[model samples]
Target: MLWFNPRHPSFFYYNTSTANLKSNYQVNTNGLIGQTTALQSVVSWNKTITKCRQNSQIIKAQKLFDKMPLKDIVSYNTILPGLNQAKNPEKVCQLFLEMERVGLKPNEYTLSMIFSAALNTELKLLVSQIHARTICLALNASVFVGSALMKAYADAGDGVGLGKVFNEIFNKDVSSWNALVSGYMELGRMHEAQKTFDTMPDKDVVSWTTLVNGYIRNKRINKARSIFNKITEKNVISWTVKINRYVQSERFVDALKMFVLMMRSDTMPNKFTYSSVLDACAGCCCLLVGQQVHSSIMKFGIPKDVVLSTSLVNMYAKCGDIDAAFSVFESVQRKNLASWNSMIGGYCRHGLGKRALEEFERMIKMGVKPDEVTFVNVLSACGHGGLVEEGEKHFDSTETKYGINAEVKHYACMVDLCGRAGQLDKAEKLIKEMPFEGDVVIWGALLGGCGHHSNTKLGELAAEAISRLKKDHPALFSTLTKIHGEKGARSTVVTLRKILNEKRFRKQEACSWVESPFHEM
Candidate 1:
């Protein structure tokens, strides 16, 4: 009779009325059963490790891997990627060495992960060692490995190495081409990037976007737009890049027009797209356009994550709608540091120093740590509200309590704070005591205070410092002229005015935005 083994479903046992059956069965089946069970265990372990990695429990995955009684190449491959994801390049290299010690050879996937890990590290020697290994193993021909090597070399700024890897690819895919183009772009070699992009037989959305982004990075907006226009199939990323570059260039109107065109297309605008659009609205202070975007965001039912919520807060605040900004801030389920900073900045912009300070306190109470930007806004609020004591306390606490070294901008804020409260002597003393040399901003702050207090001597000193730093600064000469005139120095004012005329100095005209029924300007 043949009896099926339920535990090992694929195997069957033959039982007969013979005394030799037991020994025969054991001899034939023990090795096979043991191998089958071991294989099953490895597979099960791999699944658990993969689950741990997917859940971002990399430490748990490493622990499981350490406890494994048996490990194969697949086990190393599985855990190596998790370590790479965790940005532990040292651990990845260590495990790779361990694999070598255990007599396991790495496959293409292993080399790819190692190359990825190498990209994050600045160890040129480690990269060379890995490259030599790939050549020895003849795995350099692998498209996967080749692309990764190109990226690693690109990041190292080794154009020669990148070129060598690209030439060695056995079957060049679009990814390989894209990698080369991206490498050139990263190195700021736009000509080479364009040449490689043009030579590609097949182009995906990523390829197009990469080239466009490369042009934008190199500050070739016209070239970027030309490439963007040629893309037959434009994805959200493609459109977003164009719009974002427009915003960055301060071409807010162009960004809005692009957004309008993007909406007319089938591709839906994502959170990033909306963020850029909001920035454009803020730039021009177009409240109507901002409200329309807010309506669209609600209509699309997009989840207001921290980034999007923060963007909305900034837009509303900049467009002179503080109430709406605060409402958006309140609605955020999970507020981040940026969210708090934006709210505080909004209050400062509107001269609500007390409110801004209150918000800062609320942020600290909620355990959100303040960064350099946070303190800048807070100090500016103190300057606006004439809270000199409060500003000095926060400024001092920045380094002592928060461990954030006061930067030049922080010093400028302090100068402004003191200068505003008519403490011109204190402001000048602060500048002289600064560890770093005072810049034009610091001098300008002191000069403004001098002009307000009619101190011609200190004003001349501030003007001289400004002239030394920025010779062509029209505002410096203009402000200095005003200081001299206020001090009844008619001859000095006349000389400054003549110099300004000769230099063709003109102050930038300030403009305000107003919505009309027919159009906007």
Candidate 2:
């Protein structure tokens, strides 16, 4: 005979006493009697169901669960987590209701799983119902359940519901407090998030990190840094968040300095940290620092996943190291679309137009579909290499074959191709036939082509279109001045030069940087 404890319904105890041997009866908390053999069979079935779920065989687990002769709260609980893992929220809700209908009272674990599964706004009403049920079962005070409820409301963007759940928690732990703070952060209520952090009775690394991330998300980098500096013990996530924000804000120098500080503090850089650092290196063209970072990644034996590999390819390509970029691209075991795009873009950037086109063809032969970005690079490659026929073929294929509509940028590439090939009329016609209004870039491409081929008439038209878009563009005036000077139109040259002077237009001087031994720049 086996007896189940009321407080811990999942656990069973076998009766050793043989006083009622012939009857073979046992009394459990549920007031049910059964032979010990039947209880053993249930235990075996439960173990099998658990193993199936663990192996990601959720369908098998569900089938086994349905076939079980006896169903209890434990059986439902076991299957609920698998359903949640599979992201079948409807099934989770159905199972929960079924448990209720069968008089199987759910424990804290079941409620927590349900709350975690019902995350989106579509399940907001269901979350409220579960909250009410938790209260009815006197399980609302359970820290685990309360934290899950707080997170559900947080994800659903229900600030009031999240705050109410937080207040109702009997003994709030750091996780519950973090949930509340995270909720406020998600709602973009930074002041409340900060206040909650200020009043946390106890704070963990996650608590501090959450507040910092919230500030970063709200574009409050200075405040996030101030809080980060206050943390006595900083973890990898904290450092990564600060560094990533710097990279995003184009503060590449600051991002590098932070990476140096993170290394000084002996905090290991994860894949995300490395990705941001590589981007910073690419932004400033700091090849030396990028090389050192790459060495450290190898020294630390970091796994080069597809994302990190793509970043490496981009950094190398941007740093004028196309060979190295190609090497990294080759090493990527699973080349995704991003990896292919980075490699192709690198080739186009280096004036290796033929190589870029070849690689694009290779990417296609590998069964990789080209995206809009891929086509942009491809068209640019054709323009740079003076492959006008190839460029037109690709431009036509964008709509006819690939189903990708030609954007303005693609059309600009086509105009540049025709202009480079001394086909001024074709370039002008391409601009006129564009589906949308030609922007400054489209006109700029045609103007560049006209200047190259000394087509003063078309150059004048392009300059006029550019002036309508931007009244005082220095490049537009400068290019027009050159075209008029070449045509011996002194009066027109004087007028363009006078406009340049009146607008106080000065082209930004181009400069380059070389990496120095000094770490602090």
Question: Worst lDDT window (10 residues) for model 1?
Answer: 512-521
What does candidate 2's lDDT look like per residue over 1-521, in tens digits? 34355765545444445453322134553533443556678778889999999977788999999888766667888899999876689899988887776556789999988888887737766778788999999998888988888888878777998999999988888999998898899789998998999999999988988898788777888988898899999888889878887888788998999999999999999999999999999989999999999999999999999999999999999999999999999999878778999999999888899999999999999877787999989988887798988998999999898788888778878887888789999989988888899878778788877877788999889889887877666777877888888889999999988988998988533210001111111
Give model 1's TM-score versus the native structure. Answer: 0.72
Backbone clash total for model 1 is: 0
RMSD versus native structure for model 2:
10.3
The C-alpha stretches of model 2 lying farther than 4 A from their native spots are 1-189, 196-207, 217-219, 501-504, 507-521
Least well predicted 10-residue stretch by lDDT in candidate 2: 511-520
Estimate candidate 2's alpha-carbon lDDT, on a 0 to 1 scale.
Answer: 0.83
lDDT by residue for model 1 (117-168), tens: 8875765447768888999889999899998888889888889999999999
TM-score of each: 0.72, 0.64
Q: State the displacement of the C-alpha of residue 359, model 1, in Å, after optimal TM-score superposition.
A: 0.9
Candidate 1 to native Cα RMSD, angstroms: 9.9
